[model samples]
Target: MASEANPRQGRPSMTSAMRSSSFIKEHQQYRPPSKPENHYGIDTVVEDLQASKISSPRQISPFNGVPSAENPPTIVESGVSHELSHPNCTSAPGTKYDKLVATLFYKSTSPRVSNTVHSPVRVPSPTRGQSPKPHPSDSEFPPNMSPSSSIDTFPLEPPASEPEPLDHLYGSHISPMCITSFLHLMSTFPLPPGTADLNSAHRCLKLDATHDYHPTVVELTMSPAPSLDYLSLEDLRKHELIYRFEREWNTDVVLRSDTLWRRYPRLVVFDMDSTLITQEVIDLLAATIQDPPDLGARVADITHRAMLGELEFDGAFRERVKLLKGLPASIFTELRPVLDVTNGVVPLLRALKKLGVKTAVLSGGFLPLTSWLSGELGLDYSHANEVVIDETTGRLTGEVKGRIVGKERKRELLIEIAEKEGIALEQVVAVGDGANDLLMMDAAGLGVAWNAKPRVQMEAGARLNGDSLLDLLYLFGFSDEDIQTLIA
Candidate 1:
C-alpha cells in the first residue's frame, strides 16, 4: 500500500516498487520449475506424505495418468491449511523409502497460486465502517482522481507505517519525546507569566522551563511508563493542557514537540497567514481600500469562513481575489507596514537556522507576500499561488495563474523541498492553522497546528494554542541559551 511507511520498505527504492509490480505481471502466465532427481531422501518425502494422512497418493492424484472421479482436481488445499510438500524429498536407493517416494511422485502434485496481488478489487476494510475519502496524504485516491490532487481531509485512519514512534520503535521502549508549548494570550502579546504552571503536581506531566522568553519555554514531560498507552498518552496530556488553560488565554492550542526534532533530523516547514503572521494577507488586502469600509469586514468574513471549513477554500479564494480586482500591486509593500508579524517568528526561525536546520514556507496565500516573507525571515524555500496581474495597468487581474498550490500541492512542495535538500518525508515537520494545511501537516513527520481552527487542532499531530511562535523553538529542544547563542 502506498501509505505503508517507507512505501519502499523491503524494496531498495522507488524503482524496486515498480519492479514488484512488474514481477506480478510476469507471473500471470506461471511456469513450474523443472523437477530434477531426488534432493531430500525418499524417507523424508514419505514422512511428508504420511503427515498428510493420505492413504494412497495415486488414488486421488494423477491416478495412472488419469483424473480420479472419486477424489477430483477440485480438492485443493489452501496454503493456510497446509503448505504443499516440496518435491525435493529423497532417500537411500532401492530402499522402502525410495519406493514410497516414487509412488508419491507418480501421483499429481499441485502448486498453490497466490491471489492477493492478482485481485483487481480492493477488499472493503471491515473497520472503515463509513467510507470517507482517503486523504491525499495517505496516497489513497478514487478511481478517476490521481494522487496529485490536494483535497485536504482527515484520513479515516492515519497511515501508521510511515512513522516509527507511533509504532513505538526506538530501542525496545517508546520514544521519550514530549511536546512542550508556551502559550500566548493573543497573537501579538507574548505568553503571560504563570499561566503554564510548570510546578503542577499532575500525575501525567512534569514541567521544566528551557527558555527565558515571555511565556517561558517549558518541557511537558511524561513518565516512561505512562498511565495510558504510548500512542494516546501524549495527545491526552495535550488535551488536558488545552482544556485547563485555553479559555483563560484567548488563543488556539497547538503542541510543539522537541523529541521528534531531536530524534529525526528534519526540514521544518510552516504555513503563512494566521500561522506565522498575525493577519490574513487576503483580508489585509481587502482592508486596504476604504471606498466601502465594510469591504474589509466582508473579505475577512469570507476568509474566516474558509479557514473554519464552513466555505470551500478554492472558491472562496477566487471570490476574495475577484473582490480585490483592480487593486494595485503596490499593496504588497504598503501592507508590509500593517502586516502584524506573529510573535516568535524571528526567534523561532533564527533558532532553527542556528541549529543547521533548513526551513521553508508553503502558503495558500499569494507568492508576493510569501516571497517577501521568505526574504524577510531568510527562509530556504517559498511556494504559493501567483496572483495574475495586468502588468500594463499595474493592477490585479483576479486570476491565479498556473497551478494553485492547495493542500495536496503543499504536501508535494514539502516532498520536493525535502528531496532537494536530501531529506525524506519522514524527516519533515509541517506547521499550519487553516483546513487547507491539513494534508501537508498529516504528511509531515510532525504536524503542529499553531493556533489553528477546531478541525485542524483536532486532527494535527500536535496543537500549540498559545500565540507565541517562539515557543516552537523550545518545542524543538532548544534552550533559551542555545537560541540566544545560535542567533548571536
Candidate 2:
C-alpha cells in the first residue's frame, strides 16, 4: 500500500511536468529557425534554410512533428548569440521569448535598423515560388564589408557654391602685370548712382585685354533709373569724376552712349592750326618777317590768348594778320613742304576714309594752308579765311576777304556741312584743342578735346590726354583688332 501511494503521488507530478514541456516544445517546433547574425535579412535566411533542408534533412519526431537538432538552439540579438537549452525553453516566460525574436527581426529586416534591445521587429512572408531579389552590394555598403554586417548609413550632402565678383573684368589695354591691382581698384571703385541695380545680374564685360596705363573702356550693362538718361550719366561722369581720374591716373575715362550714331559718325570735322598741324600757320608766317624780329613771338602769344578765349578771336586774329603785312606770297610755297603733320593724323584719316566717312578741316587759318593741308590729308572738304594778296607785288595786303572762320563760323560751318552731306548733327564728330572749337563741338554728336587747354578740357564732351590721336578709335568702341582690320 505504501509503494502504491508513492507511485500515485509521483505520477501526477511527472504528468504535469511532461504536459508543460511538451506544450513549449510543440510551440517552438513550428516556428522558423533564427538566421545567423551575419546573414543579410529574412529573405536570405529563408533561402539558406531551404537550401539546408535539401542538403541535410532533419528527422521529425513522430509524437509532435518537431525537427531534431544536432547542436543546441541559439537566440541572436545584433550579431550576439545566446544558447537556449531545452530546460530554459520550457522554464522561461513565453512573452520573454517572443520579445527576443521580435528584436532580432527588427535588427535584420527593419528599413532603418537599430541595435537597441526590445525594439519590435517584423519578418515579411515572401510569396510562394517567387525568387527573392538580391540586395545591391555596391551602393548600400563598402565592398570590403560583409553584407550581413551592420550598416552605419550617413546620407551624403553636396557642397555649397560661391558667388562670382562683379568688377573682376577689364579691356585689352590692361596689361597682365597690373591686372591684380586693377582688379582691386575696380572692385572697390564706386560706380555711378542710379546707373546699376545692385541686386540685379550686374557684371562688367571684358571687351579685350588690359594694360596698366592705356585707354580702357569698362563695358557695363546699365539699368539706369527712370529719370536719368545716358547723356545725363555722361555729364555726371565728366563733371564729377573725369578730371580727378585723369589727374591721378593719367587715364581718360570716356563714358560714351551706346548709339550707332555716336559709335559710327558719318562726318568728322577737324580744326586747323594747332590741331591737324604742329605749328600755327599764322605764327609760322610771322616768323618770316625781317623788319620785326619779335613779330613771331608776338603773333604766337596772340594766337595762344585767342585760343584760350581770353582775347576776341576776330580782333586778335586781324591784329596778328596786320603784323604779317608786306609778306611775300612765295612764303606759302616755301612753308608747305616744311609743315609737320600731327602724330597719328595720317593713319587716323586713312582709317576714316576706308570706312567711307567724310572728313573736313574748317580752319581759322588762311585758305591756302587749309586747302594745302586738306589735299595732303585726302580730306573731303576745306574752308578757311582767304587772305587778300596784291597781284602787282605778289604780297599779302593785311586783309582777310571772307568772314573769319571764328568760333561761331566754325559751328555754322559744321551744321552746314552736316546738312549738305545729309548727315544729322548727332552723327558728326568734331575734334579740336582751342576754345574756338567748343561751339563746333557742342553742335556735333561727340566732341573730343585733344590735349587742349584746361578750360577746353573741362567743357568738351570728352578729352584725350594720351599721346596718340589713334587712341580715339578706342573711345568710339573700336577694339584693337577692329582698328587693325580697318587700318590694314
Candidate 3:
C-alpha cells in the first residue's frame, strides 16, 4: 500500500509536467535510428578518392580540405571532423586522412587537374590616364554596412576631356590671310629645301600682319629667289608641290629685308598698251582698215615683229603708219569707251598712291594714247611714240614725230624718270609682258613679268601668272586690310 501510494503520488506530478511541455510527444513522432549513420559511406569515400586521382596529376595535400598551395578553403575545424568521420574518409589531422579530404575537395573545386605549372590568374592593369580599380582582396566592409552610407569612400572617376580652342578657327575674327599657301608658287618664288628634306617643299612660312620680323619658317634669300626662273620647265617639274603654300596668304617673301621692294621703295614703271591698258593700241587702228585686207594684215605683222624685236620699231612704225595713212582721226575716240583694264589695277594703283610712290609709263605704244592714260591714272611721267597728222587733211602723214619708243627708248625713259625723281636705279620697279619690255626690266631694281611671254617670264626677276595686279601689294608686304583702306 505504501509503494502504491508513492507511485500514484508521482504519476499526477508527471502528468502535470507532461501537460506543461509537448516537446517529448513531438520527438516520438519520428521513427529514425537511435544513433545517426554516416551519410557518406566507405564506398562513397573510396569512389571520391578514385575520381580525384584519375582526373588530376597533382599529388593530393592532406589536412581538412585545404589545398597544398594557395586558395585554401576556409575550413571550420569544429564541423570538418564530424563531416569527414566515415571509416575510409579522412577525419584526423594525419597525412592519410588529410590526403583523402584534399583529393575530394580539389576535384570538386579546382578548374583544372594538373601537376604542370599553371599561370596565375591575371588581373587587368589600369589603362593610361584612367584611375586604377580597387582589388577584390582589399578590406571588406562590415556585414552591417549600408551602400548609401559607403558613398563617401567611392573610387576616383576618370577626368573629362578638354575643350578645343576656337580663336584660331576661321570666321572667329577677320585676321590677315596666311601666305604660306602661295610661297612656293610662280617661276621666281624663293623656295629652298626645308631642313634638307625633299618633303620640305610642302613646308611654308607663317608671318605676322606687321611684316616687321623673321618668318616662322626659314627666311628666304633674295639671291636664291630667282633660281626658279632658271629651271627648265622640265627641271621645275621635279620640285612638284602637292598643294599651294599659304595659311590663307602670308608675307614671308615681302617681309625679308633683302627683298627688292623692302630694300628700296622708289619708282614703279609700267608698259602702256598690254600692261597698263589691256590691248594692243595699234591693233585698234588696224581694225578700222578691214576694207583693205593687205593693208591691215601688213600693219599687224609689222607690229608683231616690232614687239618680238624682229623688226626695228622705228621702221615698223613708219610702215604701219603708211598703211593707216587714210584712217579717220576719230579712231582713238571710237575705241576709248571699249578699253578693258587688267584686274586689281585700281586696288594696286591706289595702294601705290597711298605709299607716295612715283608711277610712270614707258610705252612703244602711241604717245597720244599713253599721254591720255597718264592723266587718267595720275602718272608722274609718261613717254611713248607720237603719230604726226596732216592738220588740213586730218589724216596720218605716214611718219612718227619723235624717236620711236623702242626697247632702248623705254630703258632710257625709265632712267630719266628715276633721275628726275632723285631716285637710284635699285629703287625702281619695272613690270612688263613683252620681249621689248625686257630691256627696261633689266634696268629696273626689280622687274616683274605680269602674265608675260614665256621668254619674258623665264628671264624676269619674278612672274605673276594670276591676273590680279593686287598681288603686287603682297610683294610690298601689304595686308588685305591695308589694300582695302587704299581702295576706300
Error of 1 at 312 (Å): 1.7
Q: Model 1: how far is 179 from its true place, Å?
A: 15
True-vs-predicted CA distance for residue 99, candidate 3, Å: 91
In order, candidate lDDTs are 0.60, 0.65, 0.57
lDDT (C-alpha) at residue 369 in model 2: 78
Task: Write the residue-wise lDDT of candidate 2 on 1-488 in tens digits.
Answer: 45555545545343454454334444443434454343334443544555543334675333333323455555567989865443322213442110000000000111222222332233355689987655443334333322433445422432232222212333224333223333333334343443322211122222333343342443332222122333354454454433443332324555555455656778999998878887789988988886677888999999999989899899999898889989998899899987888888899999999988999999999888789889988999999999999999999999888799999999999999999999998889999999989999999988888878877887887777655677667656566677788888
**Order of the predicted models by lDDT, top scorer first:** 2, 1, 3
TM-score of each: 0.52, 0.58, 0.50
> Deviation in angstroms for 406 in model 3?
0.7
lDDT of 1 by residue, 1-488 (tens): 45658655687444454454344343445422233233533433543434443243354443243333354334345654422332212222553110100000000112122212222344455565676544344344433333334446545443432111211221111112222122121112222232221111111111224352123233333212122232243454355444433322222333332234444446999999988888889987887878777999999999998888888778888888988988999888877767778887888788777668899999889998889889989999999889999979999988988877778788899988888888877678899999989999878877888878988877887667554776565445455676667667
* Model 1, runs deviating above 4 Å: 1-217, 220-264
Q: How many backbone clashes does candidate 3 have?
A: 15
Candidate number achieving the greatest TM-score relative to the actual structure = 2
Model with the higher TM-score, candidate 2 or 3 = 2
Question: Which of candidates 1 and 3 is the stronger one according to TM-score?
Answer: 1
